[model samples]
Target chain A: MAMPFEARYRVYWHHTDGAGIAHFSRILAIVEQAEEDFYASKGLLHVHGRLPRREVYASFLYPLRRGDEVLVRIWADEVRRRAVRYRFEILNLTAGRKAAEGHVVAVCVDSEGGELKAVECPQEFVEAWKEA
Target chain B: MAMPFEARYRVYWHHTDGAGIAHFSRILAIVEQAEEDFYASKGLLHVHGRLPRREVYASFLYPLRRGDEVLVRIWADEVRRRAVRYRFEILNLTAGRKAAEGHVVAVCVDSEGGELKAVECPQEFVEAWKEA
Candidate 1:
Protein backbone atom coordinates (compact mmCIF):
# COMPACT_ATOMS: atom_id res chain seq x y z
CA MET A 1 0.00 0.00 0.00
CA ALA A 2 1.11 3.55 -0.70
CA MET A 3 0.51 6.67 1.37
CA PRO A 4 -0.43 9.94 -0.30
CA PHE A 5 -0.30 13.57 0.84
CA GLU A 6 -1.04 16.93 -0.79
CA ALA A 7 0.08 20.41 0.19
CA ARG A 8 -0.36 24.01 -0.98
CA TYR A 9 2.40 26.62 -0.73
CA ARG A 10 2.43 30.33 -1.42
CA VAL A 11 5.34 32.09 -3.09
CA TYR A 12 6.86 34.65 -0.74
CA TRP A 13 9.27 37.53 -1.29
CA HIS A 14 12.02 35.58 0.38
CA HIS A 15 11.46 32.80 -2.12
CA THR A 16 12.15 34.96 -5.16
CA ASP A 17 15.05 36.84 -6.68
CA GLY A 18 15.16 40.37 -8.16
CA ALA A 19 13.83 38.90 -11.40
CA GLY A 20 10.75 37.82 -9.46
CA ILE A 21 11.39 34.13 -10.05
CA ALA A 22 11.98 31.53 -7.36
CA HIS A 23 15.59 30.65 -6.80
CA PHE A 24 16.55 27.04 -7.46
CA SER A 25 17.25 26.51 -3.77
CA ARG A 26 13.82 27.72 -2.71
CA ILE A 27 12.11 25.03 -4.76
CA LEU A 28 14.03 22.38 -2.83
CA ALA A 29 12.75 23.86 0.44
CA ILE A 30 9.13 23.49 -0.56
CA VAL A 31 9.61 19.89 -1.63
CA GLU A 32 11.28 19.22 1.74
CA GLN A 33 8.31 20.64 3.58
CA ALA A 34 5.96 18.35 1.70
CA GLU A 35 8.11 15.37 2.62
CA GLU A 36 7.95 16.36 6.30
CA ASP A 37 4.20 16.45 6.12
CA PHE A 38 4.13 12.99 4.53
CA TYR A 39 5.99 11.54 7.49
CA ALA A 40 3.78 13.32 10.02
CA SER A 41 0.69 11.94 8.31
CA LYS A 42 2.14 8.43 8.78
CA GLY A 43 1.85 8.71 12.57
CA LEU A 44 5.60 8.37 13.01
CA LEU A 45 7.62 10.52 15.41
CA HIS A 46 11.04 10.46 13.73
CA VAL A 47 10.73 13.88 12.16
CA HIS A 48 13.93 15.26 13.68
CA GLY A 49 15.88 12.04 14.13
CA ARG A 50 19.09 11.44 12.27
CA LEU A 51 17.98 9.56 9.19
CA PRO A 52 20.19 6.45 9.07
CA ARG A 53 22.30 6.06 5.89
CA ARG A 54 19.86 7.06 3.18
CA GLU A 55 20.52 9.71 0.56
CA VAL A 56 18.13 12.30 -0.90
CA TYR A 57 18.60 14.21 -4.15
CA ALA A 58 16.46 16.59 -6.25
CA SER A 59 16.50 17.98 -9.80
CA PHE A 60 14.58 20.93 -11.25
CA LEU A 61 13.01 20.33 -14.63
CA TYR A 62 11.36 23.73 -14.96
CA PRO A 63 11.77 27.11 -13.36
CA LEU A 64 9.04 28.27 -10.98
CA ARG A 65 8.14 31.93 -11.05
CA ARG A 66 7.18 34.03 -8.05
CA GLY A 67 3.42 34.45 -7.38
CA ASP A 68 2.69 31.11 -8.98
CA GLU A 69 0.24 29.00 -6.98
CA VAL A 70 1.64 25.50 -6.80
CA LEU A 71 0.44 22.11 -5.62
CA VAL A 72 2.77 19.36 -4.43
CA ARG A 73 1.85 15.68 -4.36
CA ILE A 74 3.79 13.13 -2.32
CA TRP A 75 3.54 9.37 -2.06
CA ALA A 76 5.61 6.36 -1.11
CA ASP A 77 6.68 4.28 -4.09
CA GLU A 78 8.34 1.29 -2.43
CA VAL A 79 9.59 -0.12 0.87
CA ARG A 80 12.56 -2.47 1.08
CA ARG A 81 14.34 -4.15 3.97
CA ARG A 82 15.76 -1.06 5.67
CA ALA A 83 14.87 1.57 3.10
CA VAL A 84 11.82 3.40 1.73
CA ARG A 85 11.45 5.33 -1.53
CA TYR A 86 9.20 8.38 -1.87
CA ARG A 87 8.23 10.47 -4.89
CA PHE A 88 7.11 14.09 -5.34
CA GLU A 89 5.34 15.98 -8.10
CA ILE A 90 5.10 19.76 -8.35
CA LEU A 91 2.24 21.15 -10.42
CA ASN A 92 1.79 24.70 -11.61
CA LEU A 93 -1.87 25.44 -10.99
CA THR A 94 -2.15 28.59 -13.04
CA ALA A 95 -0.55 27.16 -16.18
CA GLY A 96 -1.71 23.56 -15.77
CA ARG A 97 1.74 22.08 -16.27
CA LYS A 98 4.00 19.74 -14.35
CA ALA A 99 6.71 21.90 -12.88
CA ALA A 100 8.95 19.23 -11.36
CA GLU A 101 9.18 15.64 -10.22
CA GLY A 102 11.54 14.22 -7.57
CA HIS A 103 12.15 11.14 -5.52
CA VAL A 104 13.82 10.54 -2.11
CA VAL A 105 15.22 7.37 -0.53
CA ALA A 106 15.42 7.02 3.30
CA VAL A 107 16.99 4.19 5.30
CA CYS A 108 16.01 3.14 8.81
CA VAL A 109 18.73 3.19 11.42
CA ASP A 110 19.32 1.89 14.93
CA SER A 111 18.45 3.84 18.08
CA GLU A 112 22.07 3.56 19.27
CA GLY A 113 22.91 6.13 16.56
CA GLY A 114 25.55 3.81 15.16
CA GLU A 115 25.73 2.61 11.53
CA LEU A 116 22.52 2.67 9.49
CA LYS A 117 20.68 -0.65 9.73
CA ALA A 118 17.65 -2.23 8.12
CA VAL A 119 14.46 -2.83 10.12
CA GLU A 120 11.04 -4.27 9.47
CA CYS A 121 8.27 -1.92 8.50
CA PRO A 122 6.13 -1.09 11.53
CA GLN A 123 2.93 -2.77 10.38
CA GLU A 124 0.72 -0.55 12.55
CA PHE A 125 2.29 2.64 11.25
CA VAL A 126 2.11 1.44 7.68
CA GLU A 127 -1.56 0.66 8.08
CA ALA A 128 -2.26 4.05 9.56
CA TRP A 129 -0.51 5.72 6.65
CA LYS A 130 -2.52 3.76 4.12
CA GLU A 131 -5.68 4.91 5.81
CA ALA A 132 -4.58 8.50 5.81
CA MET B 1 42.75 37.07 -12.49
CA ALA B 2 40.97 35.10 -9.74
CA MET B 3 39.03 36.78 -6.90
CA PRO B 4 39.29 35.50 -3.31
CA PHE B 5 36.94 35.65 -0.29
CA GLU B 6 36.82 33.81 3.05
CA ALA B 7 34.08 33.47 5.69
CA ARG B 8 33.75 31.35 8.86
CA TYR B 9 30.47 29.61 9.70
CA ARG B 10 29.56 27.71 12.87
CA VAL B 11 27.69 24.42 12.65
CA TYR B 12 24.35 25.21 14.30
CA TRP B 13 21.72 22.81 15.69
CA HIS B 14 19.52 23.55 12.68
CA HIS B 15 22.48 22.68 10.54
CA THR B 16 22.75 19.04 11.71
CA ASP B 17 20.79 15.83 12.01
CA GLY B 18 20.12 13.00 14.54
CA ALA B 19 23.49 11.53 13.53
CA GLY B 20 24.90 14.87 14.71
CA ILE B 21 26.38 15.61 11.29
CA ALA B 22 25.73 18.66 9.12
CA HIS B 23 22.86 18.19 6.69
CA PHE B 24 23.84 18.50 3.03
CA SER B 25 21.55 21.48 2.44
CA ARG B 26 23.21 23.52 5.17
CA ILE B 27 26.54 23.11 3.45
CA LEU B 28 25.04 24.61 0.27
CA ALA B 29 23.80 27.62 2.29
CA ILE B 30 27.30 28.27 3.61
CA VAL B 31 28.77 28.06 0.13
CA GLU B 32 26.13 30.49 -1.13
CA GLN B 33 27.11 33.03 1.54
CA ALA B 34 30.68 32.87 0.39
CA GLU B 35 29.63 33.56 -3.20
CA GLU B 36 27.63 36.58 -2.04
CA ASP B 37 30.68 37.90 -0.21
CA PHE B 38 32.73 37.41 -3.34
CA TYR B 39 30.36 39.65 -5.32
CA ALA B 40 30.22 42.26 -2.58
CA SER B 41 34.02 42.35 -2.47
CA LYS B 42 33.87 43.49 -6.13
CA GLY B 43 31.58 46.53 -5.51
CA LEU B 44 28.76 44.96 -7.55
CA LEU B 45 25.26 45.92 -6.36
CA HIS B 46 23.17 43.23 -8.09
CA VAL B 47 22.98 41.03 -4.99
CA HIS B 48 19.17 41.02 -4.95
CA GLY B 49 18.68 41.24 -8.71
CA ARG B 50 17.61 38.37 -10.91
CA LEU B 51 20.73 36.81 -12.25
CA PRO B 52 19.96 37.30 -15.97
CA ARG B 53 19.91 33.84 -17.55
CA ARG B 54 22.75 32.38 -15.54
CA GLU B 55 22.38 28.93 -13.95
CA VAL B 56 23.95 27.77 -10.67
CA TYR B 57 24.39 24.21 -9.37
CA ALA B 58 26.17 22.55 -6.39
CA SER B 59 27.22 19.05 -5.39
CA PHE B 60 28.50 17.50 -2.10
CA LEU B 61 31.51 15.18 -2.18
CA TYR B 62 31.83 14.38 1.53
CA PRO B 63 29.80 14.50 4.72
CA LEU B 64 30.61 17.13 7.36
CA ARG B 65 30.14 16.24 11.02
CA ARG B 66 28.62 18.51 13.63
CA GLY B 67 30.95 20.87 15.59
CA ASP B 68 33.37 20.67 12.70
CA GLU B 69 35.11 23.89 11.68
CA VAL B 70 35.12 23.85 7.90
CA LEU B 71 36.71 26.37 5.55
CA VAL B 72 35.30 27.01 2.10
CA ARG B 73 37.40 28.32 -0.81
CA ILE B 74 35.73 30.14 -3.75
CA TRP B 75 37.48 31.34 -6.89
CA ALA B 76 36.75 32.00 -10.52
CA ASP B 77 37.75 29.06 -12.71
CA GLU B 78 36.71 30.28 -16.15
CA VAL B 79 34.75 32.98 -17.96
CA ARG B 80 32.89 32.41 -21.19
CA ARG B 81 30.50 34.53 -23.17
CA ARG B 82 27.54 35.37 -20.88
CA ALA B 83 28.79 33.02 -18.16
CA VAL B 84 31.13 33.04 -15.13
CA ARG B 85 32.25 29.85 -13.44
CA TYR B 86 33.10 29.64 -9.70
CA ARG B 87 34.38 26.72 -7.64
CA PHE B 88 34.22 25.82 -3.93
CA GLU B 89 36.30 23.50 -1.75
CA ILE B 90 35.27 22.48 1.79
CA LEU B 91 38.06 21.61 4.21
CA ASN B 92 37.73 19.74 7.51
CA LEU B 93 39.93 21.54 10.04
CA THR B 94 39.89 18.91 12.81
CA ALA B 95 40.86 15.87 10.73
CA GLY B 96 42.75 17.74 8.02
CA ARG B 97 40.76 16.30 5.15
CA LYS B 98 39.00 17.98 2.22
CA ALA B 99 35.36 17.64 3.22
CA ALA B 100 33.84 18.57 -0.20
CA GLU B 101 34.47 20.24 -3.53
CA GLY B 102 31.79 21.94 -5.66
CA HIS B 103 31.25 24.59 -8.32
CA VAL B 104 28.61 27.13 -9.41
CA VAL B 105 27.96 28.98 -12.68
CA ALA B 106 26.26 32.42 -12.70
CA VAL B 107 25.26 34.24 -15.88
CA CYS B 108 25.08 38.03 -16.14
CA VAL B 109 21.63 39.33 -17.09
CA ASP B 110 20.20 42.53 -18.48
CA SER B 111 18.77 45.21 -16.17
CA GLU B 112 15.26 45.06 -17.68
CA GLY B 113 15.07 41.54 -16.24
CA GLY B 114 14.89 40.08 -19.76
CA GLU B 115 17.12 37.47 -21.39
CA LEU B 116 20.61 37.02 -19.97
CA LYS B 117 23.27 38.65 -22.11
CA ALA B 118 27.01 38.44 -21.88
CA VAL B 119 28.42 41.92 -21.56
CA GLU B 120 32.06 42.89 -21.54
CA CYS B 121 33.50 42.09 -18.12
CA PRO B 122 33.07 45.19 -15.98
CA GLN B 123 36.71 46.31 -16.06
CA GLU B 124 36.54 48.41 -12.90
CA PHE B 125 34.63 45.77 -10.93
CA VAL B 126 36.94 42.97 -11.99
CA GLU B 127 40.00 45.07 -11.13
CA ALA B 128 38.55 45.96 -7.71
CA TRP B 129 38.15 42.26 -6.93
CA LYS B 130 41.80 41.56 -7.88
CA GLU B 131 42.94 43.84 -5.04
CA ALA B 132 40.46 42.43 -2.51
Candidate 2:
Protein backbone atom coordinates (compact mmCIF):
# COMPACT_ATOMS: atom_id res chain seq x y z
CA MET A 1 0.00 0.00 0.00
CA ALA A 2 1.21 3.50 -0.79
CA MET A 3 0.62 6.60 1.26
CA PRO A 4 -1.89 9.05 -0.14
CA PHE A 5 -0.80 12.38 -1.63
CA GLU A 6 -2.86 15.57 -1.52
CA ALA A 7 -3.02 18.86 -3.43
CA ARG A 8 -5.21 21.93 -3.40
CA TYR A 9 -7.20 23.48 -6.26
CA ARG A 10 -9.69 26.30 -6.75
CA VAL A 11 -12.66 25.69 -8.98
CA TYR A 12 -12.87 28.24 -11.78
CA TRP A 13 -15.92 29.37 -13.68
CA HIS A 14 -15.00 27.21 -16.65
CA HIS A 15 -15.33 24.15 -14.48
CA THR A 16 -18.99 24.80 -13.84
CA ASP A 17 -21.85 23.52 -15.99
CA GLY A 18 -25.42 24.56 -16.70
CA ALA A 19 -26.22 23.09 -13.30
CA GLY A 20 -24.10 25.84 -11.71
CA ILE A 21 -21.83 23.24 -10.10
CA ALA A 22 -18.67 21.64 -11.30
CA HIS A 23 -19.45 19.40 -14.26
CA PHE A 24 -18.96 15.75 -13.46
CA SER A 25 -17.09 15.10 -16.70
CA ARG A 26 -14.65 17.89 -16.01
CA ILE A 27 -13.68 16.23 -12.75
CA LEU A 28 -11.38 14.07 -14.89
CA ALA A 29 -9.06 17.02 -15.24
CA ILE A 30 -8.93 17.67 -11.52
CA VAL A 31 -8.07 14.05 -10.73
CA GLU A 32 -5.52 13.71 -13.52
CA GLN A 33 -3.87 16.95 -12.46
CA ALA A 34 -3.50 15.62 -8.96
CA GLU A 35 -2.02 12.43 -10.40
CA GLU A 36 0.53 14.47 -12.31
CA ASP A 37 1.42 16.51 -9.26
CA PHE A 38 1.86 13.34 -7.26
CA TYR A 39 4.44 12.04 -9.72
CA ALA A 40 6.18 15.39 -10.04
CA SER A 41 6.62 15.43 -6.27
CA LYS A 42 8.75 12.31 -6.71
CA GLY A 43 10.74 13.81 -9.58
CA LEU A 44 8.97 11.58 -12.08
CA LEU A 45 6.97 12.49 -15.15
CA HIS A 46 4.77 11.00 -17.83
CA VAL A 47 7.61 11.32 -20.30
CA HIS A 48 9.79 9.30 -17.97
CA GLY A 49 7.08 6.67 -17.65
CA ARG A 50 3.77 6.03 -19.32
CA LEU A 51 0.89 4.28 -17.60
CA PRO A 52 -2.27 4.87 -19.53
CA ARG A 53 -5.44 3.50 -18.12
CA ARG A 54 -8.53 2.53 -20.00
CA GLU A 55 -11.05 2.72 -17.20
CA VAL A 56 -12.23 5.39 -14.79
CA TYR A 57 -14.93 5.18 -12.12
CA ALA A 58 -15.98 8.10 -9.97
CA SER A 59 -18.72 9.12 -7.58
CA PHE A 60 -19.53 12.72 -6.74
CA LEU A 61 -20.95 13.36 -3.30
CA TYR A 62 -21.34 17.13 -3.20
CA PRO A 63 -21.77 19.82 -5.82
CA LEU A 64 -18.62 21.92 -6.23
CA ARG A 65 -19.40 25.53 -7.06
CA ARG A 66 -17.08 27.95 -8.76
CA GLY A 67 -14.59 29.51 -6.34
CA ASP A 68 -14.73 26.46 -4.12
CA GLU A 69 -11.43 25.26 -2.73
CA VAL A 70 -10.69 21.56 -2.86
CA LEU A 71 -8.28 19.15 -1.27
CA VAL A 72 -7.66 16.20 -3.58
CA ARG A 73 -5.93 13.14 -2.17
CA ILE A 74 -4.65 10.28 -4.31
CA TRP A 75 -3.07 6.93 -3.59
CA ALA A 76 -2.36 3.61 -5.22
CA ASP A 77 -5.23 1.33 -4.36
CA GLU A 78 -3.63 -1.64 -6.07
CA VAL A 79 -0.42 -2.34 -7.93
CA ARG A 80 0.28 -5.22 -10.24
CA ARG A 81 3.08 -6.40 -12.48
CA ARG A 82 1.98 -4.23 -15.38
CA ALA A 83 -0.90 -2.15 -14.06
CA VAL A 84 -1.75 0.22 -11.23
CA ARG A 85 -5.01 1.45 -9.80
CA TYR A 86 -5.30 4.78 -8.05
CA ARG A 87 -7.99 6.25 -5.82
CA PHE A 88 -8.89 9.90 -5.46
CA GLU A 89 -10.82 11.66 -2.69
CA ILE A 90 -11.83 15.22 -3.40
CA LEU A 91 -12.91 17.29 -0.43
CA ASN A 92 -14.50 20.68 -0.09
CA LEU A 93 -11.72 22.02 2.04
CA THR A 94 -13.65 25.18 2.83
CA ALA A 95 -16.73 23.30 3.91
CA GLY A 96 -14.68 20.34 5.16
CA ARG A 97 -16.78 17.76 3.36
CA LYS A 98 -16.04 15.07 0.85
CA ALA A 99 -17.17 16.04 -2.63
CA ALA A 100 -16.08 13.14 -4.80
CA GLU A 101 -13.95 10.03 -4.96
CA GLY A 102 -12.98 7.57 -7.66
CA HIS A 103 -10.49 5.09 -9.06
CA VAL A 104 -8.44 4.94 -12.25
CA VAL A 105 -6.62 1.89 -13.59
CA ALA A 106 -3.71 2.28 -15.97
CA VAL A 107 -1.52 -0.28 -17.59
CA CYS A 108 2.16 0.11 -18.28
CA VAL A 109 2.86 1.08 -21.85
CA ASP A 110 5.96 1.76 -23.90
CA SER A 111 5.18 5.15 -25.38
CA GLU A 112 8.80 6.12 -25.84
CA GLY A 113 9.22 4.14 -29.02
CA GLY A 114 7.31 4.50 -32.28
CA GLU A 115 4.70 1.92 -31.48
CA LEU A 116 2.92 1.85 -28.11
CA LYS A 117 2.74 -1.56 -26.48
CA ALA A 118 1.87 -2.87 -23.08
CA VAL A 119 4.95 -3.31 -20.88
CA GLU A 120 5.79 -4.54 -17.46
CA CYS A 121 5.97 -2.09 -14.59
CA PRO A 122 9.47 -0.69 -14.39
CA GLN A 123 11.35 -1.38 -11.18
CA GLU A 124 11.94 2.31 -10.51
CA PHE A 125 8.20 3.02 -10.67
CA VAL A 126 7.35 0.17 -8.34
CA GLU A 127 10.09 1.19 -5.92
CA ALA A 128 9.13 4.83 -5.98
CA TRP A 129 5.49 4.05 -5.42
CA LYS A 130 6.04 1.57 -2.58
CA GLU A 131 9.17 2.77 -0.82
CA ALA A 132 8.96 6.52 -1.27
CA MET B 1 -35.50 0.63 -21.60
CA ALA B 2 -35.25 3.78 -23.68
CA MET B 3 -34.02 3.50 -27.21
CA PRO B 4 -30.49 4.70 -27.85
CA PHE B 5 -30.00 8.21 -29.22
CA GLU B 6 -27.04 9.14 -31.37
CA ALA B 7 -25.38 12.24 -32.81
CA ARG B 8 -22.38 12.93 -35.02
CA TYR B 9 -19.45 15.12 -33.94
CA ARG B 10 -16.10 16.16 -35.32
CA VAL B 11 -13.06 16.24 -33.10
CA TYR B 12 -11.80 19.77 -32.60
CA TRP B 13 -8.19 20.84 -31.99
CA HIS B 14 -8.95 22.22 -28.56
CA HIS B 15 -9.92 18.74 -27.49
CA THR B 16 -6.37 17.53 -27.85
CA ASP B 17 -3.84 17.63 -25.04
CA GLY B 18 -0.06 17.42 -24.99
CA ALA B 19 -0.47 13.77 -25.86
CA GLY B 20 -1.52 14.93 -29.33
CA ILE B 21 -4.54 12.71 -29.07
CA ALA B 22 -7.83 13.83 -27.64
CA HIS B 23 -7.27 14.65 -23.99
CA PHE B 24 -9.11 12.22 -21.80
CA SER B 25 -10.33 15.07 -19.65
CA ARG B 26 -11.77 16.94 -22.60
CA ILE B 27 -13.80 13.95 -23.69
CA LEU B 28 -16.40 15.22 -21.27
CA ALA B 29 -17.36 17.94 -23.68
CA ILE B 30 -18.03 15.40 -26.39
CA VAL B 31 -20.16 13.16 -24.23
CA GLU B 32 -22.09 16.00 -22.63
CA GLN B 33 -22.70 17.55 -26.00
CA ALA B 34 -24.20 14.31 -27.18
CA GLU B 35 -26.40 14.21 -24.12
CA GLU B 36 -27.64 17.71 -24.80
CA ASP B 37 -28.29 16.95 -28.44
CA PHE B 38 -30.17 13.84 -27.48
CA TYR B 39 -32.52 15.88 -25.35
CA ALA B 40 -32.81 18.70 -27.85
CA SER B 41 -34.05 16.29 -30.46
CA LYS B 42 -37.16 15.99 -28.31
CA GLY B 43 -37.46 19.73 -27.74
CA LEU B 44 -36.12 19.29 -24.21
CA LEU B 45 -33.53 21.37 -22.46
CA HIS B 46 -31.52 21.07 -19.28
CA VAL B 47 -33.83 23.70 -17.82
CA HIS B 48 -36.82 21.52 -18.48
CA GLY B 49 -35.70 19.08 -15.80
CA ARG B 50 -32.63 19.00 -13.63
CA LEU B 51 -31.10 15.58 -13.14
CA PRO B 52 -27.80 15.91 -11.40
CA ARG B 53 -25.95 12.69 -10.95
CA ARG B 54 -22.83 12.05 -8.93
CA GLU B 55 -21.35 8.96 -10.56
CA VAL B 56 -19.57 8.35 -13.86
CA TYR B 57 -17.77 5.28 -15.14
CA ALA B 58 -15.97 5.23 -18.46
CA SER B 59 -13.64 3.05 -20.50
CA PHE B 60 -11.62 4.22 -23.47
CA LEU B 61 -11.07 1.54 -26.07
CA TYR B 62 -9.02 3.64 -28.44
CA PRO B 63 -7.36 7.03 -28.57
CA LEU B 64 -9.33 9.60 -30.53
CA ARG B 65 -7.13 11.76 -32.70
CA ARG B 66 -7.85 15.30 -33.78
CA GLY B 67 -9.88 15.71 -37.00
CA ASP B 68 -11.57 12.43 -36.35
CA GLU B 69 -15.31 11.95 -36.72
CA VAL B 70 -17.26 10.27 -33.97
CA LEU B 71 -20.73 8.87 -33.41
CA VAL B 72 -21.97 9.14 -29.86
CA ARG B 73 -24.92 6.99 -28.83
CA ILE B 74 -26.72 7.26 -25.50
CA TRP B 75 -29.55 5.36 -23.89
CA ALA B 76 -31.15 4.89 -20.52
CA ASP B 77 -29.86 1.75 -18.88
CA GLU B 78 -32.03 2.11 -15.84
CA VAL B 79 -34.86 4.39 -14.81
CA ARG B 80 -35.97 4.64 -11.24
CA ARG B 81 -38.52 6.83 -9.55
CA ARG B 82 -36.03 9.62 -8.92
CA ALA B 83 -32.90 8.61 -10.80
CA VAL B 84 -31.90 7.61 -14.31
CA ARG B 85 -28.72 5.96 -15.55
CA TYR B 86 -27.47 6.63 -19.06
CA ARG B 87 -24.96 4.71 -21.14
CA PHE B 88 -22.83 6.34 -23.80
CA GLU B 89 -20.96 4.70 -26.65
CA ILE B 90 -18.54 6.85 -28.60
CA LEU B 91 -17.38 5.36 -31.88
CA ASN B 92 -14.57 6.68 -33.99
CA LEU B 93 -16.39 6.67 -37.27
CA THR B 94 -13.36 7.87 -39.13
CA ALA B 95 -11.43 4.84 -37.98
CA GLY B 96 -14.43 2.53 -37.98
CA ARG B 97 -13.78 1.58 -34.37
CA LYS B 98 -15.07 2.21 -30.91
CA ALA B 99 -13.33 4.92 -28.97
CA ALA B 100 -15.02 4.81 -25.61
CA GLU B 101 -18.15 4.09 -23.59
CA GLY B 102 -19.48 5.08 -20.19
CA HIS B 103 -22.38 5.36 -17.79
CA VAL B 104 -23.72 8.41 -16.01
CA VAL B 105 -26.36 8.30 -13.30
CA ALA B 106 -28.19 11.51 -12.49
CA VAL B 107 -30.85 12.18 -9.89
CA CYS B 108 -33.75 14.51 -10.43
CA VAL B 109 -33.62 17.83 -8.64
CA ASP B 110 -35.81 20.91 -8.43
CA SER B 111 -33.98 24.15 -9.23
CA GLU B 112 -36.99 26.27 -10.09
CA GLY B 113 -37.15 28.00 -6.74
CA GLY B 114 -34.19 28.01 -4.35
CA GLU B 115 -32.16 25.41 -2.56
CA LEU B 116 -31.51 22.54 -4.95
CA LYS B 117 -33.02 19.37 -3.60
CA ALA B 118 -33.49 15.90 -5.03
CA VAL B 119 -37.01 15.35 -6.32
CA GLU B 120 -39.00 12.54 -7.82
CA CYS B 121 -38.78 12.02 -11.57
CA PRO B 122 -41.48 14.18 -13.09
CA GLN B 123 -44.30 12.48 -15.03
CA GLU B 124 -43.60 14.55 -18.10
CA PHE B 125 -40.00 13.46 -18.12
CA VAL B 126 -40.91 9.80 -17.76
CA GLU B 127 -43.54 10.10 -20.42
CA ALA B 128 -41.26 12.04 -22.72
CA TRP B 129 -38.60 9.39 -22.42
CA LYS B 130 -40.93 6.49 -23.00
CA GLU B 131 -43.37 7.80 -25.55
CA ALA B 132 -41.08 9.91 -27.63
Per-candidate DockQ vs. reference? 0.18, 0.64
Per-residue CA lDDT of model 1 for A46-103, tens digit only, reads 6325343244445444456777788888776765655566677888786676767766
**Residue pairs with backbone atoms closer than 3 Å in model 2 (clashes):** B53-B106
For candidate 1, write residues B1-132 as lDDT tens digits: 444567666567787755666766567677777777667766675632534324344444445676777887887666555456667777777557776666666665454453234465565545543443
The DockQ of predicted model 2 stands at: 0.64
Q: Give candidate 1 misplaced runs (Cα > 4 Å).
A: A1-6, A17-19, A45-48, A52-67, A74-89, A95-107, A110-132, B1-7, B13-23, B44-48, B52-67, B75-79, B84-87, B95-105, B111-132
* TM-scores of chain A, one for each prediction: 0.72, 0.88
- Mark the regions of model 2 whose C-alpha exceeds 4 Å error after superposition: A111-115, B111-115
How well is each residue in A15-79 modelled by candidate 2, as lDDT tens digits? 98777888876777898888888778877775334666578999988778899899999888777
Q: In candidate 1 chain B, where is summed lDDT lowest over 10 consecutive residues?
A: B47-56
Candidate number of the best lDDT: 2
Cα error of candidate 1 at position A37, Å: 2.0
TM-score of each: 0.63, 0.90
Alpha carbon deviation, residue B55, candidate 1 (Å): 6.3
lDDT of 1: 0.61
